[model samples]
Target chain A: MQDYSAHIQCSACPIRHRAVCARCDTDELSQLEQIKYYRSFQAGQTVIWAADRMEFVGSVVTGIASLTQTMEDGRRQMVGLLLPSDFVGRPGRAVAAFDVTATTDLVMCCFRKKPFEDMMLHTPHIAQRLLEMTLDELDAAREWMLLLGRKTAREKIASLLAIIARREAALQLKKAKGMLTVNLPLTREEMADYLGLTLETVSRQISALRKDGVIALEGNRHVNIPDIDRLLEEAGDDSDGGMLV
Target chain B: MQDYSAHIQCSACPIRHRAVCARCDTDELSQLEQIKYYRSFQAGQTVIWAADRMEFVGSVVTGIASLTQTMEDGRRQMVGLLLPSDFVGRPGRAVAAFDVTATTDLVMCCFRKKPFEDMMLHTPHIAQRLLEMTLDELDAAREWMLLLGRKTAREKIASLLAIIARREAALQLKKAKGMLTVNLPLTREEMADYLGLTLETVSRQISALRKDGVIALEGNRHVNIPDIDRLLEEAGDDSDGGMLV
Candidate 1:
């Protein structure tokens, strides 16, 4: 059973406060409804082709999507990960610049391009909020550039684990003593793509980390951090702990 | 004698339009004058410290600069190359996140931060223009992210050359058959920092490109491209050539 509610309410919703859509009012949501539609994609499906015509802009209501770029030789790079409540698509552009693929079952709350741009023009706050988010994304991208260009292979692997662990910790979960656990949302191959390394390298690095007692692995995708400080040291970051702050 | 008069104009001005200060109106310029100052740095001078207090926001009125991040062990990544017209600071940020350094004899047009933000509230147009330029910078950052996260070493070098050559071509200078050249602008060490390679790797890759006849080197700091298409192919990029188009 699927839930497809048209109204955009901020309170009591699972994604309330965190999602950018939370900023909109009932009136703005109503205006959005006049020009909006709903769409869903199955896991492993591509929602849009690279450089193909894009007639809509939208946000994710549920599930995860990834924005990826592919080379002619079949090499792929995952440039962005779109989680639930993440925004997708672009306004003022007629073509999608990258491929939007569903990494899991996904639902999108979409708006037709023309009317959405009109709404952006009429609603100054919307554009302002978008600007702020875009700036934040830019900062994140630059930070990633540093990681990709300068970090060692071990450092890269550690950084990736730290990022996942921090993100998972922020999901309003309770912390337990002597046990820190995080689920690996991505496969080794996907992690390799994101880290600019090969799958074999990713596998080897994970094993190395485990052998060095920096981490404990349970199953293929579950990570247990015995000591967060040890994990941070393995990451080669400042002793500021694994949190981004 | 300095030609300050020749450089003074608004963003709408036809001849002197490269500096970010060009976005100011006459009144805004006067306001800027009250809080502004000029400083010059010799080539290789560090202008700002990463993670330190940033007292001002400014632009390069002449010459070139770079924004770079360094690892704790001294590995470096050039996050941005600041050409004329490039804004040098973030508005809401109180401390520098990366180090800024001059790559040539640099003259800057700067404004004190408190006064600038105060003015931004009153002059929506300036804020709007700033927003547009910021958005453009963000796009450039995203493009760089793809370069760092995905490109091979050879592709990275070729892409950097192509970017420099394309921007140089846009100045509409007279073309010389043997002079489709770009001044290296960066030293071998700086190139290493920017490309995430060692100095030896940078030299080796440049030699390989020359040996392959993809590009011609004139001394160590100048490059000549026989054909843009050849360069693009070596970059592993499609010859959409939309940049020049």
Candidate 2:
């Protein structure tokens, strides 16, 4: 058996506290380390395509990946956006259901499918952790559904920005208050795809938000939110601040 | 203590084969039955509101319930449509996350929260089955995201009809291949909230589909499809047909 433990240390990984292995104890971690390997993908690379046979199930270790679906006419909608620590692939199903692509340079900690399923039977921690993660993803997906189905183009832009900023703030705790800067992983066209708007609408809405003093753009990819609460308001979120995140 | 087992037999339950209790054996089912009781809600009744304390987690036993979120200004989006056998309530959370409303008269099999959580800790089958159900719901939610974010109003209508038809077919089993009729649980206004269209737009699209011979309407509720395959095409689904289900 290959000693896969040398790939990465779970102790020092950035996403250690949040990933599927979050609830793992030392022995369970060692078991996972033995079966795990790391895979990397460049920006704009396909991680896995829908209906393809997947040999492994994994978690996003670094950067961003997107779960997207394309219609027969070539129209695409991004269903889920994966930041570090978000899971990928489903257990029990050999074929992937949606196209997963690396929207940013990506790295994944993977375990071969069969053994992982077997281990899950014996390891309740992993299965429980996966359930929690899946539940959270389901909630996020529902929130995104609300954004897609009802929010206006301008609200969509603000909501996306606020979501990205809030996620960033989650990682760098000190930068959450007052003014904050966030780098958007998607381009304008991609944002349009995610929000169900045309590229022109996305661009126009971003400009409109900037002009309205709800946000500021530092560079092409960097957005400056002088007040996070103000941005949330523009997103049509409630004063409770629980709407988008 | 209250002789709850006398309330219902797991074997006779309609959703037994599909719900969170699906994998439970006779012994496990006995434990569930001890803690289970039935709750009924009338059409248009609010089952639970967002953030309200929920005493139990349960499964929809009959009719339809909708998971919806509303903004301060009164914009509402229906995030999930629950059918019989669909699970309800998050396991770890004490409060509900969305307003669950019975779109039709509904019945649910409920287990009080504390005992249910304790039961899950000991019963791998229940937890495993719940995990599987959650994962399936997540997949459905993502598919819904795609519909909300990308599909046109006409395509959206077709997709909703196709989804309801396919789900109904899953229960009936014999009607999968060809022509079929489906009972739409949501009214035009409810459907509008669901599909992100105004009521007028929904009525117009339904009229357009009927005029084009894509679907036939009987009164206000039942929809007749002469060709399910043709309807799927109008929904922009691929030939292999895994898009909406």
Candidate 3:
């Protein structure tokens, strides 16, 4: 990890409009600026190990990170796929509850926990925003539960792609419709971990979907959806929308 | 549903101390009382359906409710298992997002959504408490994701029982240790749905646990854990503590 605190300004931060500080007014932004720092991590770096006493609460300003848990014997489950603007850590919690790792080169805008918690008590905007984000996270977690518990392997694969593509579109203020493209944010093994499937199964399912013309591939990591609606149908979702969290 | 507003007061409510309004002072309590009402549902009744226009936000006062999502092809997944003091509806969301069914006879204390949203804005204590609760719920949901995605059938069943027993003990300010007892809140089929297993799988696992003397059972619902530590071990959890959400 490296401190890039001096390299960025909150005003120039790419995720400023979408992060935990999104609701902050000018004065509030300055207040946040007082406590905020930036931490950068390389791909595959462990950001926080479970049970570590984290000194900060933060949000991803760039790239992706994963929140995962492992069993006693070593089985792993990916519980959260964090994207740009997604808040990380719990305000009142000092100990990290899950292993957080950067899935790609990442940057986070962080605030010291003590000051952040104190500020939350005094700032309605910050607290309200955090609450809203937490609720959204809960909803996402529940939806992920549904996918893990009920969806078939192929459906799970399709759902993961659909979720990524839709979110990608959302970031651009558009709908994932007739034709679109998306990058597979997770690798095959990571996808397997996230979906609770064997890596072979994930590869086979992706191949099956490709052979069925539901999607086009530009390699293992880039996906082209020839028809997004058909992809949703394959994902066992409604055309209007599916997989909100 | 029947109105039971006259039968209860917040001061006498069983879940008051643990509920959404847990931090409310006298003035806040009175304001809440003015907007609150109680609705009761019989066992096996539908409390709310997906896409239905819900009129209020609420919390369960008694009994259990299951939040479920169904695919167009009729497959279902139990996404949330609501217990007493568990919140019922999203405060700002007027459309119910999942099918909420009473797994047992249930009573909910509800507040109209508009006022509840207004009150949340004005009451820092309420918002702060809600944020805390929401964060806790998010943690629980993530742990559920781990269970659904990683645990074996036997481990899943053990985890569910262990979770219930722990929560039951928590209510009494006791730790679930030697010879603890708990009731199966969901039927075999519901457990099957919740655990991503076939009904036979759930039953088989339960029997296997009994045969191993990891648990003892009387009738279909009551369970006796002769060794809670052993039970937690079987649940793929740490003996010191595990499964907080």
Candidate 4:
């Protein structure tokens, strides 16, 4: 886990233009600065427990976290994955609805809930940006629901890889094409929770994809795509591979 | 379908305080009125096909509509259900991502896309309210994901019943409890799609619940819950059954 706690100016933040505060002007940014602080969590740490009152709202500054639900019988499902620049916490709701855990060493830029809510009331840019981000998250959730409800095990694994690759490509500002390499952020167990499969199934599917040449495994945590379009086809998504135009 | 095309003033609208225009002042309402129109669809009518261009955004004024996705092999999944006062259409995006179909004869209050986007920009209240509504929808989507990924066939059916009953109760300003009757807006086939089950499985589960006295059938579409708590228990949800307060 990298320690990034050294006070960095908001202007110098890597996710300045992509986070919840993306639309804020200098004055609005200063207002946010007064109420904002950074917090870090080690990998495997629980950030917030389900049904507990949340004291702040924030955006992921680095690393990954997941929102998950646990059943009475000990079954679990991952509902949302927060990557760099993804927003965390509901603005109006005080209680967290799912348990949030840091999947990797994580850093977050957080705003005290009440002050942030007050700032949103006075800043149209912040409110509008948050709205756009929420809509995007809703769309992503619906897409994941389709995968959970209908996709085959192989398709589910393929879809998860494609999603992660697309996000990684976006972060690098590069079009995914002939060959791409991605680091699997979650473990086999975590992947099982996200895809509604068992760890054994996840391992089998990965081995299948590798044997079929859709992907090449460099190590347990690394994947190399020989052909991005082929992988997308297996995923049952558009062959364009979600290229940003 | 109701011909609500007979120009009802926004001031008298049943959802005036609940829809996207919830925060609008009299002057803001007049601005919305200038660009608004009414449209109605018959039961089973397709409102918009997935990936098609959408020309307008609207609020459901009556009846039920659903957003669904169909795979190449004919497997379908219902991603969203829109009841009275639910907003439809993405504001910033030009294309519809899901096929929206009317499950019952439906009425909607619509605004031309360009005009509605313009109105959203100038009316901070409208934008703010839309943000709030979108957030609520995101939460609902996450909850649905949990049901889709982690529940058993029986639990899924019971959960669906609980959700519909809760929504119906909320519409009437009452909490779901005691003897509660709900008119299911979707057909058995549609219910199967929403629950990610075969139609036969859905039917069998419904019959099993009836036999177990968790619910009683008035007709194919009408369900009477003698004890709402028992139904919730079967649903594997919080015993309070999603009471707002």
- DockQ leader: 2
**Worst 10 contiguous positions by lDDT, candidate 1 chain A:** A1-10
Reference contacts preserved by each model? 0.50, 0.79, 0.78, 0.73
**Stretches of candidate 1 exceeding 4 Å from the true structure:** A1-29, A173-177, A239-245, B1-36, B121-131, B173-179, B239-245
Q: Candidate 3: where are CA atoms >4 Å away?
A: A1-11, A14-16, A172-178, A238-245, B1-11, B14-16, B238-241
Pitting candidate 1 against candidate 3, the one with the higher lDDT is 3
TM-score for each of the candidates: 0.85, 0.93, 0.92, 0.92
Native contacts kept (model 3): 0.78
Clashing pairs in 2: none
Tell me how far the alpha carbon of residue B213 in candidate 4 is from the true structure, in angstroms, after superposition: 1.6
> What tens digits encode model 3's per-residue C-alpha lDDT throughout A1-245?
11123223445553345655566788877877888899999999999999899999888888999999988798999999987777889888879989999999999888899988888887876777777777778877877887899889999999999888877676644556667888887899999999999899999999999999999999888999988878878888643444552
TM-score of chain A of 4: 0.91
Q: Which ten residues in a row have the lowest lDDT in candidate 3 chain A?
A: A1-10
Against the reference, the lDDT scores of all candidates come to: 0.71, 0.80, 0.81, 0.80
- Per residue, candidate 3 scores C-alpha lDDT tens digits across B1-245 of 11123223444553345555566788887888888899999999999998899999888888889999888887788988887767777777778878999999998888898998898887877667778878878888888888899989999999988888877676655556567878788899999988888899999999999999999999999999899888888989643335652
Candidate 2 chain B, run of 10 with poorest lDDT: B1-10
What would the per-residue lDDT of candidate 4 be over residues A1-245, giving only the tens digit for each residue? 11122212344543346655566689877887788889999999999998999999998887899999887778889999987777888788888888999999999888899998988787877777788878888888888888889889999999999888876675555678668889899999999999999999999999999999899998899999988788888988633323210
How well does candidate 2 score on lDDT at residue B175? 55
Answer with 1 or 2, whichever has the higher TM-score. Answer: 2
